[model samples]
Each structure stands twice: as structure tokens, then as C-alpha cells.
Target: MGIRSTLPLCAVVAGTAALQIPLLSPHQQAPLEAADKTKPLINSSALQDLISGDRLFTRAKKLFDIAKLGEDEYNHPTRVIGSAGHEGTLAYIYESILQLGDYYKLDNQSFPAVSGNVFESRLVIGNSVSKSAAPMGLTPPTQNKQPVHGDLVLVENEGCQIGDFPDSVSGNIAFIKRGTCPFGTKSEHAGQKGATAAIVYNYEKDAVQGTLGTPSPNHVATFGLSGKEAGPVLEKLEKKDKVDAIAYIDADVKQIITRNIIAQTSEGDPNNCVMLGAHSDSVAEGPGINDDGSGSISLLEVATQLTKFNVSNCVRFAWWAGEEEGLLGSDYYVATLPEEENIKIRLFMDYDMMASPNFAYQIYNATNAVNPNGSEELRDLYIDWYKDQGLNYTFIPFDGRSDYDGFIRGGIPGGGIATGAEGIKTKEEEKQFGGKAGEWYDHCYHQLCDDLSNVNMTAWIVNTKLIAHSVGTYARSFKGFPKRTSSVASSAYESEAKYHGSMLYI
Candidate 1:
């Protein structure tokens, strides 16, 4: 899925006033400079203090300041792609990179991106209205269309094939399970069965806002429901109960072209490079502070601080645009990179939502059956770091749901971290992270309220430190990861013992 909605949503280590980030044009490319090879590359301890919660907060305030500005304000509140505020965001990072001067070579890869919105989504089950109803992305406008009604019919097994629909489904609402195929495919099948509307329940988990993948007349206006919520309703229908429902969706469809920023160290092994990424653009509704700004700003702070030392392996930092538009920017960057250049990337780590009020420490599960090779090592780096702190952590699959989607598809080893988003927190998680068990991880997920207050300070601070821990360790030495045969590093070492050697917090 493209950067998801239900979708939702960094910083530094000091006084942000001390940052003398130089401004650079969006299209400007900084010339590469020779690295002063004489300076020794700093180890984890040499740079630990630099990754400060205070510092992270300082830089994070800059983004909030930008996002607080009104639409006409110089730094607009919403960093929607191509918006003035988004431009402000780009300028901030460009300047941050430019501040490093000769330390990194900068490349601004621009792409034509697309995005749209489901303007209104409403539902009424019997006499009660549902506040949880949401329109599937790419759902056609219901403004000029007929409202959905009649008996709700349950479709079997993921509803991928036309046979899943029965004669009774015609002229009714199709209740489908989310599995096997794209949401669009299921919805299309419902239409093929003559259903006026479609409701796809989350087969294994809680309710989620989903995309139909694309627009199609074959699709009936679709709504995603959670299994917990659907179980009783399904049982009632099975008992031959009369359950009437309605589904209405209207949308605003348009497009915008955007770019992804890529900056690389001037020094270090060119054959083997470590890549760090975060989405720079927010969703259509909110400022996306925790969604990605936490990750973006943290990387900026780290990049600026990184100039203070040298690195044995090249480190590349990317601020991806149009991520909320389905990871468009990152996908475009990967698709266009020459195959030879693509092979040069030794590892890719993505950081999307680094702050959620009711947060869970999520590390992408790289050892899972589906993950690409080397992904496990990337995940272990953070899991081990969290374990050392005696903190509880959980796994998030590196499936194609984020900016890392493209890299994983291209066979590059990739993994990432997320605080949490629209998913409801369980009681067990509540005991661990401490917040309302039934509430959304980020209550304001994909909404205009996903601003400064939506973040959990403790989660924000800890994750930022972990990011620095991973970046600094990899930049100094690949260690636990395989050194490319193309690189000169002769010996392979493990960082399991030295991973936290320099951190002051732990």
C-alpha cells in the first residue's frame, strides 16, 4: 500500500539557535568536495551526547513553528506537497545539508507525484450512525450517485473471485473480509455481484482505513470495518436477522508533482553505503509532525552533527516527498536509479512515525518469511538496543506499506521503526507503554489534529536516541552487516557488545 492513511504520523540532540543551516534552492545541487581523509572517524561514544532529547526537541520546534503558520504564513501549518509550507520544509533540510558544506554531496531528485482525497465518508447502520466509517482511497464520488441500502450480504473468503458473491448479494450491501487481494479487487467483485455498497472487515485485526489501490467504476463505495466490530454483526446476520445499512462516499481528486531529497557523505567507502530515509511530506489533512517530521528532523539534526566527525562507510540521508501519497517519491527514486548504482546501497533504514501518544516500540520484523536478506540484521540492531534498556518492544513487518517499499522490492536489505498510528492499543500494550488501551496509538492519525500535542514525549525521545545509535554505528562500521565484496574492509565484526558503549542515556 502507498504511504497509508489511518495513516498517520523527530529531533536533535541542543539549542536549535546554534544551528547555522544555510539556505539552498530546491533544484540546487551542491558540488561534491574532497574529504579531509586525515580526521579519524568517531566511534559511538564520541557522538552519543550529540543525539540529545533536548537537542531533538529544539530542532523539532522548528518544524512545529513552520506548521503553526497559517496557509498564508511564510511557514504554512500543513506541509502538503507543493504547498508553501512544504517548500519551507524542503528549504530547512536543504539548508541543514548545505550547512555541512563539503561533508556531503547533495542531489535533489525531483519527480512528478500524485495525490487526492475522499472528501466525505458517512454511514448509517439501521437507526444508528457510525463514527468509525471511512471511505476507501480512490473511491468514486457518491454526490451524483445513488445511496446504498438493502440487506447486508456476507461474502466468503477474501471476496477476490466473482463466485464469492451469491444471488442474494445482488441489490444488497456486500460484507467482505479483507484478505488475498487489493481492496479495489474485492470492491469490484461486490459491484459485479450487483451489490450497491461494500464493507470489508479486517480479517485478523482491528479496523483500518484502506485504499482501493485505484479508481474503478466496478467498485461500490467501500468501507473498512474491524473484525472486533464485525463479529457480532456477522453473527446476527447468520441468525437471519434484518440488518439494514448505508454507505456514502464523495471525493476531491487532483494531482501534484514533488521531489525526494538525497544527500551522501563526501568521504567513506563508495562501494558500500548506509542509507537512512524519512518521508518529508505530510498527508492532506494535518501537519504530520509525528508521522514523519520526527524522523525527518532527527535525520537533519544527525546529519548536521555528523559533520563533526568522519565516517568509514558513506552515509546517505533522504527526505522523501509524496510518501503519504503511497510512497510515490521513494518508489520513483528507486525505479529510476541505475541498476549498478542500486547495487551500491548496502543497507536501507526507514523511519516514518517516530512519535505516537499511546506508542509501542515497533521494530520491523526482518527475520519473517517475507523479508529480503540482511533485513534481520537491521532489525536486530534496534531490538537489541531496546532490550539493553530493559524496555519492551514489538515487531512491525517490512511489508510494502512504507517508504522502504521500493527498496525492499528492488531486493535491497531494508527495515525501519514506527511508534504507532491508527491501530488500537491492546491492554498488554497499555501496560507496557501506558495509555488508554482502547484508544488509537495516535488518536489524531491522518486528521488535522496530528500536530505537536499528539506525540508521546518518552517514545519520541527514546526512538530518536535509537536512530542515532543505529546511524552512528553503521556510519563508523558496517560490523554486523556483510561488507560488499566491492569494498576494501577485510574483517567482519559484531556490534552486539559495542552497540551502546557511548550512549549517555542508557
Candidate 2:
């Protein structure tokens, strides 16, 4: 298929107010409210009511604080995969749900993922050295930890095609602007043109934190520079001035084991499961509170509240890891799952960014789905909820930019909501959503500033309510929802699918 496309609890851990997470048990079961036969069926209103902004914020704060408990060698405050922060996130989710007793079956599915850690990255131009450079994820490090020294040659037209690289680029560093193509593609093109390295600068003011999708033989060591840092070099190049530079990136890219938390309601029919997911890991730069901590905590709140009632269809919640690097955790789960188990999933909903400060109620536009089995219905359900609530909403393409990509590729219909991401809010959206038209939905997205202050509490609560509504509706019944059928082969999506986050588009 081608797509287009926190409850606060305070606990002291390591001098930080982290969540009071308990030790994980292989399996634990205790009687909960779902056991009573007289319990009422889950409804949207009830489920939504259980979602408290105060509670959610509390939890979000705790998650942010936990990220401060770094385990990586750098020990920065990050919840990136293979770090203590991520493990703490997993433990917190397990302990939170454990409070619900035996209502759900929880499992931590472990897998190894190739994670890239950039030890050093910089762009040295004349006497000016900018250490604000970051290596694109999954990109190869400079050979022998050596810097690539060459004259900076600006690639024309965003450097998406071979023609963009001038003959003068041979043995030089390709100075490219980010847009229109994957960073990998640009790097590959630069390598093909005999460029010693590629330096892709962001179009936005912020530093470029992107991925090359995967390692490629044609890719040379690549680095990214923010618009501010690259401005002087760009001005010099535009004026036809000779700008010599040194690009260096020392990174360690290796496969490391991580785990995904999968929990399903034990009370419902497992044959027809309504699945929801949010990435548990953050980018290495910061605590991913708004990026996905909002979504992760939303699921936790919903799961805890759902213990009050039973469901007809099983509701499964997943905290996927390695989402920031790529959709590695969810992809691994879908790839390893047996077809018999796979077919049992009725629909999958992904909630990635739920609380962009300058937010919009953007639902996943399932109309562009590669496999439209039950996707539109899922989208319409959220749309209908928004309409009923008298909220203005818009659509974002199903561009295989989130965790929903794997399920949709497997012919399982998928849909969900997002506040928004790096996309600048348009004037029309501004009128509809009451946010600044020219600013990014979340200005702090993927940056160290994406901490507790980055979130919009109002939008977070509303989006969480929407998630509850959708989860409750699907859990109660699948009436009128289309049955799963053979979708376009997974191979069909291989060519066009974008594995990176929402910011990068084909």
C-alpha cells in the first residue's frame, strides 16, 4: 500500500520525583470490578469521564521526571530506547495497570533493535565551528572516526535527484537543504555524485533531528545542522564564496534488546480485539512528554478506568519502543506474530502526538488508506465524536508516518488522532483551531524543551477523551464495522512507505 500518504503521583527515585513504579512480575492476577456479572457495559461518556486532566498531568509530570533518571552512557534526561528512562516508563505502565487487578493480561514482548548513538557531530567552517550538528538516525559514522574535509557545494533543488548534484560536488561536501526527500535519499545521491559527505540543514529554525530510514551502502556519513547554524555558510555559498568545511560524526549503530508492553483485557473476546498503541520511547534529545508521553499516559488512564466494566471485544494497549528511531518495536511485533493471532485483531488505533501546544483536532484521514477495510469507519467514529462535542476538526493523511503503518500494511484497518506535529498551522486551521497560523503545532517538538511545559493541558484532556470514546465504542461492539479481508500485499507498500516520524514525508 502506498500511503500517501498524567496522573501525578509523586515518588522519590534518585533524587527526582519519578513515578512510584513497582517491580514487574512474570504474571500477576487479582480480582477486579470486571468480574461482577452485574457490571455495566463500557460507554463513551463513562470512559471519557474517567479521564482527568489533573490525573493525566500528574502522570505526565512523573514520566518527564523519570526521563531525568538516565541510564545511557550520556546519562541525559531522555527516555530513548535501551535507557533507564524507557525501562522506567515500561515499569510504570505495568505497575499502573497492575492496580486494575486481573482484568487484563499483560506481557512484555522483548526484541532487539538497531539503535544509533551519535557520540560526536560537528561542522567546522573556517574558524567557525558549530557543534549544534546532529547525525541523522541510522546513518553510518565517519569512516575510522575521521572527518570528511571538502569545499561545501550547495546541491540545487533540495538535492532530491541526481541532477541536483553539480559536477563540482565531486570529492566535496554536498550542502543540501532538507525537504522533498528522505535524508537517506539525499545522502545516497550525494555519495553517488562522489561527495565526501552530506550535510542537510533544516528548513525550520530548530536543529534537524531526522532518520535516514535505514543504512544504505550508498550513504556516506551524514549530519544535520539547524537553519540558524547553517545560515552563514548558506549566505557565503549563495554569494559564490568559497566555503571549505569539515564534517565529522562518530556514531555507534548496533542492535540492542528492548521490550514492548502488550496488555489486553482478559474479560472480552480475544478473537475480535480493538488495539491501541503509543510509542514508549523518546528521541535522545529530551523527555518525550508531549511527543508521546501524552498518548502513553492516556492509554494508561483509559486502561485503569476500563477495569470498571466488561467489554464484548478485547481492548489491547501497547507501549511500543523504538518508535523514535523508526517504527521498530511495533514492526517487530507485527512481523513476529503468527497469522492466526494477527487475524484476530479487528482494528488498530495509534495515538502518537496528542498535545501539541498550538494544537488542532486532526484525525487520521483513513480515506487514503492502503487497505480501507475498516479504516474509514474508525476515522468516522472519531469525526462523529468531535462533531457531537461541537469541536472543529480536520484530517491528516494516512502517510505511514506512525505506529499504525504495520497494521495497515497487514490489511488490518487503522485510525487515530493527533494534535499535530512540525507542520506549520495554516491560516484556515488557525481560524478553526484558534492557534497562531505560522507557528509549528509544537514548537518544542523533538527538542529538549519538549518537557512538561511543552504540553497543552486543554488539548491533552480533549484528545484523551476522544481516545476513550473511540476505545469504549469499539470495545462494546463491532456492529456495522467491516470484517478484515485480504488487503494489498505488504510488498505493495514497501516502495512508498515512509518509516520515519510524521515530519519527514515522501
- For each candidate, what is the lDDT? 0.70, 0.80
How far in Å is the alpha carbon of 267 misplaced in model 1? 1.8
Q: Which TM-score value belongs to model 2?
A: 0.80
**Candidate 2 per-residue lDDT over residues 1-506, each given as its tens digit:** 00000110111111121121222221111122243577787887998988899999999989988898774554568898878888888888878776676676667777888777777777787778876677778778776778878999998989898999999999899999988778889999988899888889977777886788766778888887898888888999999999998888888777799988877776655556789999999987788899899999999988888888877666889999999888988888888866766777788999998999999999987753445478888889998988998999999877778998888777778889999888899999999999899999999888788899999998999999999998888888777888766564354455556445543533
Model 2, stretches more than 4 Å misplaced?
1-35, 71-75, 124-134, 144-146, 151-195, 200-209, 216-219, 224-244, 489-499, 502-506
Counted clashes in each candidate structure: 12, 13
| TM values, all candidates | 0.78, 0.80
Model 1: lDDT to the true structure: 0.70
Maximum-lDDT candidate: 2
lDDT of 1 by residue, 4-39 (tens): 112100011011111322222221222232245565
